[model samples]
Target: MKFTSGPITRPLKMGAYLKVSYNEKRSQVISWEKVNKNDVPTKALAKLQ
Candidate 1:
């Protein structure tokens, strides 16, 4: 998978595999998943948020 600085500030044209987790009553992204495009959901491609 590829890496970008800011998804909220600056979005990319490609898809990414995110490693999301919940801890301390908060949600955070640990790292990128680095998976294939097929592994991602169709809705995620439509909306990157």
Candidate 2:
């Protein structure tokens, strides 16, 4: 699965990262994960291993 940060604009609103897991039919999401930047402090975001 892949995850990406939400829409970001100037002034900073501290968005979030979204990821959706699909089921066998792929008609609906089976599970989801969300991580908010609100608690991570406003800073430059980067990739990690």
* lDDT of candidates 1 onward, in order: 0.55, 0.49
In Å, residue 37's CA in model 1 sits off its true spot by 1.2
**Clash pairs (backbone) in predicted model 2:** none
For 1-49, candidate 1 gives per-residue lDDT tens digits of: 4345545544545554554443645544454445667777889767865
Single out the weakest 10-residue window by summed lDDT for candidate 1: 1-10
Over all chains combined, what TM-score does candidate 1 have?
0.38
Backbone clash total for model 1 is 0
CA deviation > 4 Å runs, candidate 2: 1-14, 24-26, 36-49
Which lDDT value does model 2 have at 16? 51
What is candidate 2's lDDT per residue for 6-42, written digit by digit as tens?
A: 4543232345554457787767666766656544434
Candidate 2, lDDT over the whole model: 0.49
TM-scores of the models, in the order given: 0.38, 0.33
